[model samples]
Target chain A: MSAVDTRVPQPTTPTPPSPRRMGPDARRVTARTVRYTLLFLFLVFVLIPVYVLLVTSFKPGTEATLTGAWDLPQNWTLDAWREAWDALSPSLWRSFAIAIPASIVSAILGSMNGFVFSRWRFPGSDIVFTLFLFGMFIPYQAVMIPLRQLTSDLGLASGVPTLIVVHIAYGIPICSLIFRGYYSTTIPNELVEAGRVDGAGLIRTYALIVLPLSAPGFVVTLIWQFTSVWNDFLFAIFLSNTRNGPVTIALNALAGGQLTDYAASMAGALIASFPTLIVYIVLGRWFIGGLMAGSLKT
Target chain B: MRSRIRNWGPGLLMVAPSIVVIAVFVYVLIGATVNESLTDRHTAAPAENYVGLENYANLLDDDRFIHSLKNLAVLTVVFVTGTLVLGVLWAFLLEKGVKGEGFFRSAYLFPMAVSFVASGVVWRWLLNSAEGEGAGGLNALFGMAGLDVLQNPWWSHPDWGMAAMAVPAIWQLSGYVMALFLAGFRGIPNELREAARVDGASEAQLYRHVLFPQLSPVALTALIIIGHMSMKMFDLIMAVSGAQYLTEVPAVYMWQALLTNDYAKAAAIAIVLLVVVAVLVVPYLIHNARTERQR
Candidate 1:
């Protein structure tokens, strides 16, 4: 059906009304009701799983089973949450230990690479950058066996440092792309020329001029890198043993039992997800912008 | 000449670590994997000698690899269609403008922030296949509504279990697709819509003929992103269903093969996955590069 019926006169703005309908009042009522109903339904759909996780985790194991899945717990208890936290917190701490350093290192490295590619382009820099971009799409599956062999040979098998190095290596492409894109727009060649004219060397120009002007770019890259590394399960599971595993692996193990401890599992999921969720809730716009930037370069 | 050499040195130094890291980890590793795939690794330790596409041919006879491919095909179709339909629909609804738009937008995107591992845990609980008093989550909701007949074996059903896996996949990624489409919708200027309306086009006709054509690039981008994600899907399936060969995708198959030290088979699976991902992503990369060059 046509959203705007040809028979009905359309409003100039998006506030939906049809002058040719029965009455303006009736049309407005219909539009509002329809909009609210649709939004409410979609909101419920989006929130239902999250709601279940939250309520179930807040519930005692018995209460979670006895109550309707959607019902608020009659006797709210943090027992499941405490148990899950006690079990999963070490891995959570390990994830933080891995992700933060990895993200920071990647961002700084990406910034330098971005600076060279964007402002200080040399011969074949474009080719080199394209080579880096290809790394973004190479399925980790393709590289894992060899990577595993390489790491173990080097005595880095199951090392957090190895995970950080792997993440930084993979993180280079998108982070560089983002920073290059940002610098190409935000920092002009004239500024670099200005620095050069002052007899500043390449490193000096970058250190004084480019580095200072890159906070926003750094934020975007850091958030993107942090989230990807933190949430990564494939690499963590393949590379690290249980003792050194990240929260993702721990949470997977928590949920991966025969007798499904639904409440504890849900609690573990919630606890494990907090860091990324906090980043999203606080800097959501930037996070969405980062996603768009990484994918929609064209 | 010395000054010029020195001038180039700093920039190269800045990018040297990245170049070196990528060369070893990505390029050299890819070469090593291709080499491993061509060798015979059925023994305790992998053989370094070439076998001339034997592993590739062996994949043709491997029932599980073929079945996993079929399962992947099913997952791709279901996951891609669900993400696109739901994503575009939500984008359109939000574009129509609603009260508390920010709240709804954030709510829609919050799922994307939660890792697939977490989502898989929650979904497994909700979609639990237990019948009667042991029923929980959606099945429980159905039973409470006196729709006991409606409860089905979600991921436990032998036939439709693969399709049931799409539920969690859609939940995690559709919001990302929505964000993409929403950006595309917002990028379109109001003048175009006004111009279409002035030309006596209905909104449906305007969207079908004009807006959709503009959004096709975005649609392609979404397809590629989702295609690669689902094809290489590992964690969600591992968490939700735990390597049930019925829902085994290539990534999982590769993981199992690696664990068993079947290096050749694992390398073959990895190569196949790489090629599939390349087929999905290379065109987009080339297109992006071309456009960047044009700019």
Candidate 2:
């Protein structure tokens, strides 16, 4: 229906009133009620799974039956939380180990690349940047075989270090894209020119001028990279095994185990999601900005 | 001038590391995959003799690969449509100036932060196919509300299982699409809407005639972004259906092939996926680059 129909009623010129029709005020009230009702229904739809996850996770194992999934726990206990933590904590720590360094390294590399592409216009720089952008869209499956071979051949068969390096390499495209967009718009050419006037060379100008103004860009890229690396499953699954793999692999194992533990699985899902959830809640504005900047290039 | 070389030198040095990484990881590896796909390499024994399109031919004839392609087609159509519709509706509602806009926006978008694995694990339970008293999750909710007719074997239905899998995908991504559309909506100047209204344009007419035409670029961006993503979807399917043939996509099949040490076949499947995505994305990327340059 029309969005105008939902608007608040404006004061209208007086006209002959009809007996059969309701007043404009009443129609406006109806529209308002309908709008809120629709929003509430959609809210319910969005929150239903979340409700299931929270409720099921709190239930004791005996009460966490599949048939009773929607039922609130008759007895709430920390058993599931404890079990999920015990199973997932080691890998969670490993994820942290992988995600932190990867984010920082990617952010740094992206900053340097972004500075050059945005400011220092070497010949064929646009072509190089476009080529870099294409890398962002390639399915990792294309690279998985050779990447695995190359890694193992280089004595990096399976570990956090290997995964981190892999992520940083892949992270370069989006990271640089974000930073390039950021620097191009936010840090003016005048600023770079001012640095150059002070006899700062290419690296010096980046260090003295662009780097100081890159905090916001760094924040956006770092948060984006961290969330991606943390939530990554494909790379982790292909690159590392259960013992040293990230939380995603462990959570998959715990949930997809032969004997499913509903409460633990639910708990594990929540536990695995906590870090990125917190990041979104705290820095959601920048995250959305990064997403839009990365995708909507024009 | 000789000075120009110095200017280029440091800039090249700065980007050199990224160039090298992408060269080795993306370009060189793609070359390697292309080469591998033509060979008879199996993990059991490294007899890497060239078979020259044999793997691609076998894939074309393979029932499972064909079925996975069908599944991807269904899943992409359903997923893309679901997210687009819901995303636009929610964005329109928010743009109509709802109170507590921040809360609604956050509530709608929080799911994007959660990993596919986590969401899939929950959705697996929600889409449980059990009927009658064994109903749970959404089915149980339906049963409780006397909406039993709405319940079905979601993600397990032999025919529409891939379509059912789009449900979780929509739930997770619709908010991001909403953000995209909302940004587009807000980008249009308010005077344009006021002018349309003054000219006796109905809200529907205004949207159809003026607003929507302007949103084409944003719509294209969302479509390309969502399209390539659905084409390469792996984690959500693996997490939800666990490699069942009912919802297998090419990416999952590739993973399975790799696991079985079918190196050449997996490489072929991967190259096929790469080609599919490139066909969809490359033109859009080039168009975008050209437009940016003109601007």
Candidate 3:
């Protein structure tokens, strides 16, 4: 490990080559300026859209137009929000009614699947897990038509419950992938063996040891899946009728196939983005920690 | 024996529900698609007559299908290369261990968590050439600079339109790929780079010889994921571009197949997608199997 013990200052920008060295003050100033500038630029890039969305959503169309999209409004009118909310109410109800249940159901089933795969070293476990991985790669587009036909044949084309089944079916892939990886890495095999040795039954061992241990990862998966199901426009539009269509489809319809309604639509979109965005902000740590938990360990 | 049964039964029972869901959804749906590909079907009902090869032939002949395949190929190539190159570069920069890493990392990654619709909206506003006064964000900025290139309203050519559409996708993804590369980078022990540096090797040399070899597996995984994601891209295309059938990718084209009441054609296109994915994935699985067995 006998590299140059020299803490070489990197080229932060175009600088005259000065004996390939610099004073501590020079280094500190350069590095700090670079860091602060990067942070400021990145923050602006992120916060600008949120600011725009918030300001425009609270203004009437006329005020928004006069102020420009990025400018502050003189009058904070709630009329646009009221309009958006009125239009999106049906969709909000539908997504709430459908996506929430779908996420919970999938998370539970996926977590249970993780427990089985983690605890069992049976002959076919790897294959089964691999099959699930394959499902992850199989784009839903590839099977949308056949799926629609099957649902229709089964005579449950326009129901929330049918959409729930589809959500659970597809949701298993990534959710199960995350949980299985999480359980395998985080939940020690020693604990499971100890439970078995203590004469704990399979149900007891999992209910007591496994499920609680895997809650954090499962929550991340649930939130992610919930956002996806809630935001999905393609399948929601195709699979369900107008009455049962989720917020995404409903909102797209509200756009009414025209670009002129963009300001109000953006206002509607801001509302649509609220719940998921808030969840991401609040649970940022857990969500990221879960994502990195598998990849980071190695 | 009775006690043994009690212990084993509950585990099996716990697993049965998942297996049932997978079987019904995955295997059964696959079977249904395969069957429908060979039939002339409609939304109203399945007309199950074995019209072998006809759907496949028609699907291949359709200009829309061909255009989509070409578009997806271009998109996948451009996106994967752009993402991986920047991803690796970004991770290497992060290796410098600069200040404000926490803030930078989160900022870079935040885009991934946002909905595609919002991103689509942003791209539309930034790239849209509809407004005459150069009202789009980029166009407006370019107007302030007095550069009229952004004034051009051309959306037909792949170079401008497709590449413009690709910008946000690239930005949103590079950080994710960077995260993957960072994991691989961290796994690399400090000593290897230090030893290389002691040998008077430059940073470029160190990466070219030392780091690249060490990162081969992680790079493979990243490429696979990127390839898979680009292959099935629909939402971004739909959000940024709608009603441009020729410019659309395979997934959106398949959606149109469903919309047009051509179930057999849709199934045929899906089977084509499966085949394309298999072409990439089967060999990957085989190689992985060999490597694992070798270990």
Model 2 misplaced regions, further than 4 Å: A1-27, A197-199
- Model 3, A1-298: lDDT tens digits are 2233223455455453463586654655565566567556656655555666677677677766521666677787778778878888887788888888899988888787777776754446667766776776786766676677677777775758778878888888677767776787788989988998898877787888887787677778887788778777667766886577877766665544564455666677777777776776778766565455333222
Among all windows of ten consecutive residues in candidate 2 chain A, which has the lowest summed lDDT? A1-10
Query: Which residue runs of candidate 3 sit more than 4 Å off their true CA positions?
Result: A1-59, A63-76, A152-159, A197-199, A293-298, B1-12, B42-45, B131-135, B150-155, B158-160, B191-202, B285-295
User: What TM-score, computed on C-alpha atoms, does each candidate reach?
Assistant: 0.92, 0.95, 0.86
Off by over 4 Å in 1: A1-29, A66-68, A193-199, B1-9, B131-134, B146-150
Interface RMSD of 1: 4.3
How much is the lDDT of residue A198 in candidate 3? 92
With a 3 Å backbone cut-off (N, CA, C), the pairs that clash in candidate 3 are none
Candidate 2 to native Cα RMSD, angstroms = 2.9
Q: Which candidate has the highest lDDT of all?
A: 2
lDDT for B120 in candidate 3 is 63
Candidate 1 lDDT, tens digit per residue, A102-157? Answer: 99998999899999998887777888988898898778989998898788777774
DockQ-based ranking: 2, 1, 3
Worst 10 residues of 3 chain B by lDDT: B152-161
Using lDDT, rank the candidates from best to worst: 2, 1, 3
Instruction: Show the lowest summed lDDT stretch of 10 residues, model 1 chain B.
Output: B93-102
TM-score of model 1 relative to the true fold? 0.92
Candidate 2's DockQ is: 0.64
The DockQ-derived docking category for candidate 3 is: acceptable
Q: lDDT for each of the candidates?
A: 0.85, 0.90, 0.70
